[model samples]
Target: MKSLISRLCLYASMLSAIFWPQPARAYLGSFEEQDGYRIPLDGQILSTFLAGDAQFYLNNIDANGYTGVVPLGTYPNTLGDGTHGADLSRYNAGEYGTNHSGPGGTAVDITDNSGLWRALAGGRLNEDVNAPYYNGSNFTRDYVHAYRYSGARTGSAVLNLLASETNLSYAYTLDARDLNGTAPSATAANLIQMAFWLCPSDWDDTDTDNILGISLRDAMNQTVFQVGYTGDNMLQYRLTGGAWQTTSNRMGTAGWSELVVILDTVNNTAGIAVSAYDDNTSTLASQTYVLSNQSLGLDADALTGLQWDLRGGSLSNGAASFKNYFDDFNFTVSPVLVPEPSGMLLAGLAVIALLLQRKRH
Candidate 1:
């Protein structure tokens, strides 16, 4: 009789398998895929998603994927100064004093997938050509890990959201660290931030006004969302007339923190979340806040149309300039999840039966 019960437990589990919780998936690479995979940047994601690169990039589409919290790839781009700069006048990757294919300037051997990308937001760009990785960077894995200087600001290996992207209706987060390779000091004037800007076929520096993002205590208040990196990482949101509002501090610790945002366009609200953590494993002491109809007339459709961007190094303010790194960059459009109350019960029963069998053995 006991043996029959064990078999029945297993059979019941199989019957109730449909209720198994579906795992989450990465935004860039996952839209209709199976569950429990928050970061599914695999073969299909690499070859299928549009790739970009300015400097440091891994060779071959097969070389593309995620490393821990960071995503790597060779994103091919035709606009601006990419890893291979065809025209010198456009805004490039990192910093730039001149054109490509020359001397007395920051130069590197270019590839079909590379280009002349200048440093971003008024900074210098750098990359390692001899190696496979072009820029220190994607989610099909769209999550990217960027540097404040070399392999980051100086180079770009981006995934094109135009080809593979989700709407603003998802939970997004960016985990950041100071250049020291650890949590940022709350006292330090950390200048790093992630910007999402309109990627009209013709994107350039002039589009700065169209970009907005989150950061750690931007003294200049570069964007609407920011924090001072203070105790609890106080959250701040900019108002219409440049005024600012604050909320309970986010991220319990100081070293690292995540900036989370969930866009509710239909209701004109933005649910922002943040937390402190290490090694990109996960964030700690998370917090969430809701902002309604406070977008200063900015359209949510435009926000959804923007591309993923990583930038640091002075946005032109020397005081703000500091080395920083970011990881687990995600922009998603999550669907309403279905429940499995019966499945949960069956799963528990299965576990209990397995344990009983072990004890009997």
Candidate 2:
């Protein structure tokens, strides 16, 4: 019996060594992981981005046809072709760099209902644009409406960003409403809301209803985060799971800002970071939110059920309308390895048994 027990102990020790658990490594930026996919935005077709190389997809739905310094392919007349349509050409030419009418010329016609709505509804993963607004009508039946505008008549534009993969991910949208009177609230269902960060720039005090933030329902129309803005000229974050958790680490002076929320799949946690600089800035502020199994509103089995919302209030005294611009939206999934707890426990027991056997011998 002693010999048999000694052999069993030796076998267990070997097995433990083979099945030891290893600590997870830190995940780098959006697409820095070796195993993760990287989709380069070089004005290529959507098919090029979805050729199976990118693990995450970043869609920038621009209605004014101005995609910043980047020159992406133009979707002509609801078709994913390189040709520029009449509606698209109007804005495409009036955009910043392009030369259509003249220098500093504004493209008012492009901002029309047909041009903007067509781009949103026709957007696709790598080849098309998904139109989120209604044509010739401000009201939408199924999707959310996102728009952007400057202080002037022709300074605003609207855009949408879609993830490449079909999985449940977290995202945040900033609606630039004219908070001169009261705060705004809109229903956002079928979205895994993380938090609403608001920066109120120019608005009157009577506009207490100018709510800068609020959380919405999860991807399955479930409530996850709440919305509340900090005092005018400040930034705020609100939690939605249990008790309402709030935080204020204002990052910018209050205008068009970029709020990024990412899921650290490798560490099984999530984090929210904001950057306002047009270029690079080290002063970017970010807050880390640890996610527990129960706290993750969605179940393990149900992935790819998340959605986003970008509509809520009125703009220009509820006359012109509110508009917001978004770009460079990306999401990544980390590779998780199962740990062998049983093997570790058995290894500890074997060491004890081996020591006792040696002593008896």
Candidate 3:
């Protein structure tokens, strides 16, 4: 009798398994996964409910996809004036410079800021790239890392958004150190804050009303959503003209900090998550914060571009200049998840119930 009961339970389990639905297959390619999340490809249909997805992989200096070749020396250093002058001119002309490219393979027509942006190799002193695993776990082959110079007056990488993309998710693997590969003093003056901005595509710089400089910080304060570090090593976020609310996580520790942000334009909300992998203690800390959009500021629909804004008041200590390293910068239209088939679920439950009743008889 006991053996009969065991056989009936096994049959019921098989009935449920046979009726279960399978998940959608992920896009397969080299450098396709990051931090356990699959980076979407251009024109790939992630869901019929939303538009196709797109991704920008910052794996090479030329902005092309990784080609199994390593770049040499610091980028834009061999270019005009060696101070990024030619590239600066291009940026002023609404370009991404000859050396630095924008997020979407082409530059935007607007000048958002005058920050110095370039690319650097991995495993170098003052900048340590996450090799073998870019996010300390999933993904690899990140030979180049994006550098936002702390010495520049302002630093940022901006890109235009897709037409039907109501949601945006970005990931950056970051490691901060002085020129000698040593941990820099965690002083308030040496703090570096990197924030994301969702603003209008026509965001102007040094416009007719302004004379000398355009305050990127002031402009960021006017966007639909802003989320990033607090410069003092805490994660914080805010809506336009709203007070910044802090999360429970601390960033910019000893080793690499993997950060991902998901923005919902339809709801005017954002979710910021980070996983800090410490090199010294070999430990990992993860935290997340979800900010709801209770009040709307500027119409989120008008906000068509994403901007990475960095600010560092004092970046140098003695002879060593503090460098902020960012790698594997990825942006994709957030995919709408498909719900499980309810009819199949009910059928499986019915099969299991019928099997149990037969055993009782």
On lDDT, the leading prediction is: 3
Per-residue error at 309 for model 1, in Å? 9.8
The alpha-carbon deviation from the true structure for residue 81 of candidate 3, after best TM-score superposition, in angstroms, is: 3.2
Candidate 3: count of backbone clashes, pairs at least 3 residues apart or interchain: 1
Q: How far is candidate 1 from the true structure (C-alpha RMSD, Å)?
A: 19.5
In candidate 2, what are the lDDT values of residues 291-317, reduced to their tens digit?
222233333221222223222334323
Local accuracy by lDDT, each model: 0.28, 0.29, 0.29
TM-score, each model?
0.32, 0.34, 0.35
Which segments of model 2 are wrong by more than 4 Å? 1-244, 251-270, 275-294, 297-301, 305-323, 342-361
- Output the worst ten-in-a-row residue range by lDDT, candidate 3: 25-34
Candidate 3 Cα errors over 4 Å, as ranges: 1-222, 278-280, 290-298, 312-321, 335-361
Q: Considering TM-score, which of the candidate structures 2 and 3 is the better prediction for this target?
A: 3
The model with the greatest TM-score is 3
Candidate 2 scores a C-alpha RMSD against the true structure in Å of 16.8
- What local lDDT score does residue 166 receive in model 2, on the 0 to 100 scale? 19
**lDDT, residue 219, candidate 2:** 32
